[model samples]
Target: MGGQPPAEPASEEYTVDQLAAKVGMTVRNVRAYAGRGLIPPPRLVGRTGYYGPDHVARLTLVRELLGKGYTLSAVERMMSELPDGALALGVFETLVSPWTPAEPEVITEQQLADRAGIPHDPATIAKLIELGIAERVDDGRLRIPNPDLLRTGLEVIKLGVPLDAIFEMLPKLFEQADQVAKIYVELFRNTVWRQFADAGLPAEGWPEIQRTLENIIPLAGQALVAAFRESMGREIETAAYEELGLPPDEFSSTG
Candidate 1:
C-alpha cells in the first residue's frame, strides 16, 4: 500500500523511487550503492529509504562529473577532499544545494530501452543506478535521481563512447573542471565585480549577466569541441582513415 504523504512537499522529498525515475536506475541498485558508501545513505522512513531532493541534486552532479570524465574512485576521492571534518561537510551541503539545475520530462526505463535499443536488465539498470541516473524504489517504480542530468546523459551516450571508457576518463575531466571553476570564481571577484565595481550592476546588469552565463557555457563547449575536431582533421583527411581501414564517410566534414 502507498505510505503517508512526505513531511514536506512531495516534489521536495523525492522518495527513492521518484529519484530513481528521474535518473534512470532501479531501487535495488540505489540501495546497493548506499551500501557501497558511494553516497550519503538516505534516511529510512517506515519500510522505505527516503531520499530527499538533495540526494537527487548531488546524484545529478555526480553524473555530470562522470560524463565529463571522473571515475567513481576519483569522484569519491574528490568528495572526500571537500573540507576536512564536519564543518566542511556542512559547507558542502550548502554549496551543492542551490546551484543544481532542473529539467522537464521524466525519462523512464521503457524510453531508454527504446532509444538505445537495449533491454532493461538488472545489470544495465544497476550500472545506471550507481552512476546516479536511475533509482528503483521500494514501491516498484523506477525514477530519475536528477532530472537535469537525464538529457545530458542521453546525448553523451549517443557519442559512441562506451560508458566504461567514459568512466575511465572521468577523473581527468573533473580535475580540469575544478580548475576552471576556481578561475571563474577569481574572475568574478577581480574583473566582473571589481572592474565594474562602481557600475552597481548586480541589479541593473544581473539580468544581462545571467543571460550571458546561460549563453556562454554551451557556446564555449561547442567551440572547444570544434577546435579539437579540427586539430585532428588534417590527419583524418590525409591517411588516418585509410590506415585504420575505416570508411571515408565516417570522417566526412562539411568544412
Candidate 2:
C-alpha cells in the first residue's frame, strides 16, 4: 500500500490593489511604503507580486502609527527596533480599543426618531450628532456608534426625564467621565507603563502588558460603577431627608 500525500496548507494571498483596499489605503501609498522598505517585499511569480498576512499586518501597523502622529522616520525607526511588530500592534490595538465594544447601527431618520422617542426633525438629529449619540453618514442616514448608550438614554427619557434636561446633563457627564478616564490612564502611565518603559519595552513583556491591560479594563469599570452607585445613594437619601423636613437620623426612628 502507498502512503497518501499531505494536503497543502491554505493561505490568504492578495494582489497589490486588493491589499490596498483591505487596509483602506491607496495603491500608491502601498507602493511607496514598499519602495521605502517599510514593509517586506512581496512574493513574486514572473512579473506579478502577491502579498500575504505579514504584508497586511505591516501595512496596517504603518498606517496606525502614522495616524497616531508618528513621523515616517520615527515609524521606520520603531518598526526596525521591534522583534515582532505584529505582536506589538496587537497589544497597541487592545490598549486603545474600547473596553466594551459595540456594533454601530445605521438607521433612517424616521427610525432614529421612533427608537429614541424624539421628534424626527433636523434640530433633533443635529443634537444627537452633537451629543455623539449618532453620526450622519455619506448617504444622509444616521449611524449610532453606541446603540447601548442610546438605549440607556431612551430609558432615562421614559422615566419622565425631559430630553432637554438629559441633553443639558450630557456635557457635564462626559467631562466627569473624561476625568475618571484620565485618572486611570495616569495611574497606568506612572506605574505599569513607566516600569515597562524603564525596562526598555522588551519583546517578551508584551504578553504580560496586554494581560495587565485586559484585567484593568473590567476592574476600572467595576470600580467606577460601584463608586457611582454609592455616591448616588448618598445624594438621593440626603435629598429625600431634606424634602421630608427631617434630620438624616430621623428616618430610622420613623420607620
Candidate 3:
C-alpha cells in the first residue's frame, strides 16, 4: 500500500436521514431547525431531497454558536440588520422627482410677461434673454426655458431684487445640485448595497427593500416640506415689513 493513491469517493446525494447523521443531530431537530429558518430546507424533487455543503457548514456553525450560549433571537437579529444613507444628498436624489423638461416652442416676450401676470416691458424681457434665462426663438419671439427658474425669478422680481443680482447665484446652485447628485448615487451603492450585503442581507431579499424605500422616501420628503413651509412663511412676512415698522417718512421707497 506504500506510494499507492487513496480511492476517490463516489458522488452521492444525501437524504435527510444521512444529513442528520452527518450533522450529529436527530432528524426531528434538523427538520425543526429548517422550519424555524435557522437553516434553509433541502431542495426537493418529487419527494427525494438533497443537501449541499452550504447547509452542512451552516448547521455546524449554528450548533456550535448555540452551544456557546448564543440565543436564536440574538443570532437572527444580528443577521438581519440593514443600514442605509447618512448623506444629505440622498435626501433629494433618491426620493424626489427629477425635473423632466418639456418640449421647446416659440413664444413672444409679451407672452412670457403675460404668463407671469406682470406688465410686459422690453427692458426686462431683453434682460432675461441676455441672461439666458429666456430663449429667443427664430421668429423673434422668446420662451421661458426652465419653469422652476422662471417661478423663482418671478418671485424675486416681485420682491424688487434686480435680475442680475438673482441670476448670479443660479450657476452655483446648479453646479452644487449636480455634485450632490453624484454623492447620492455613491451613497445608494455604498449604504444600501455594500453595507447590508457585508452584514449578510441576501440579494434575493431586495424586493422587500425596494418596497420599503418607496414607502420611506415619500414620508420623509413630506415631513420636510411641511416643516419648511411653516418656518419660511413667517420669516418671509417679517422680513418684508422691516421697513413698514419704521416711520413712513424715515424709510426710502426703494432700497
Candidate 4:
C-alpha cells in the first residue's frame, strides 16, 4: 500500500518494434527514451510490453526537439509544460501527410540520352535547363526533375519541333494549368473545406478532407485530358477536311 501504484495498461497499442518502426526510430532508441522518461512507459501484459499513440506522439516530439539541438533533459521539461495531445497533431501528422515531391534523379548526359533514346546536344541541354526541365549541378551531372516529362519533350524535339519553340510554349501552358488549379481549389474552398471551417474544424474530419483531395486528383487529370483530346480531335478533323477541299461543316457532322 505504501509502495508506488501499478501502471495502467493501454488497450489499443503497438509492440515495441512496431512503435519504433512507426516513429522512424530504432528499438534501442525507443527503449532508451522510455527509460529516460522522455516517452511514457509501455503497457505490460504477461511480460510483454506495448506502446500506444501517446508514446508515438511523444517520440515524434522528442526527435523533433533533439534535431533542433535541445538536450534530452531540456526536451523533457518542454514536453512536460504542454498539455496532453498538444504536440501530437502536427501540421503534417495526419492520416495522409503532405505530398512529398519526388527527388530529382542525378544522371550524366550520356545516361539521359540513353534513357530517352535521343541524341545528346549541348544546346538542347541548355534549352532544357532554361525551360526548368533539367538542372546542371556543379559536379557536371544533370538533375532531371521528371524523366517522363523530359522524354515527352525529347520526342517533340525529334519530331522537328525546335527546343526554343517548346521552351516558349511552357510558360503559357503552365500559366493555364495554374489557373485551372486555382479554379479547382476555389471550388473546394467554397464547398468541402468551407463546411469543415463552419463545423469548427474538428480533428476527426481531417481524414475526410484528405480523402476528398485524393479523389479530386484523378478527377482533375481525367477532366483535363478529356477536354484536350476533344479539342484536338475537332481541330484535326477540320484541318483534314480543309486539306481535301471540303467544307468544315461536312466533316463536322460526320465526326
> Quick one: best lDDT, which candidate?
2
Give the least accurate 10-residue stretch of model 2, judged by summed lDDT: 1-10
Instruction: Give the candidates in order of lDDT, highest first.
Output: 2, 4, 3, 1
Residue 181 displacement in candidate 2 (angstroms): 0.9
Candidate 2, residues 1-255, lDDT tens digits: the string is: 246654332368788999999989999999999998888887875567788887888889899989979999998887776546467677777776855448899999999778767667888789989989899999989899888888888899878898889999989998998999999999999999899889998889888888998889879989999999988888888888999998988875322
Compared with the true structure, all predictions reach lDDT values of 0.60, 0.84, 0.62, 0.74
Cα shift from native, residue 206, model 2 (Å): 1.1
Give Cα distance to truth, residue 95, candidate 4, Å. 11
Residue lDDT tens for model 3, 58-144: 566556556648898774553234222122122223343333345444677777777666788888777777767788767888766
**What's the lDDT for residue 35 in model 4?**
84
Q: Compared with the true structure, what per-residue lDDT tens digits does model 4 show for residues 128-179?
A: 7887889999999999887767777778877878667888898898799889
Cα error, candidate 2, residue 15 (Å): 7.6
- For 42-153, candidate 1 gives per-residue lDDT tens digits of 6766566677655665565556556658887886775544322233333334344344556333556777666655566666667767765677766655677566565565
Q: TM-scores across all candidates?
A: 0.39, 0.77, 0.38, 0.62
lDDT of 4 at 244: 89
**Order of quality (TM-score):** 2, 4, 1, 3
Q: Is 1 or 2 the stronger prediction by lDDT?
A: 2
Candidate 4: worst-modelled 10 consecutive residues by lDDT: 91-100
Which model is ahead, 1 or 3, in terms of lDDT?
A: 3
Query: Which candidate's TM-score is highest?
Result: 2
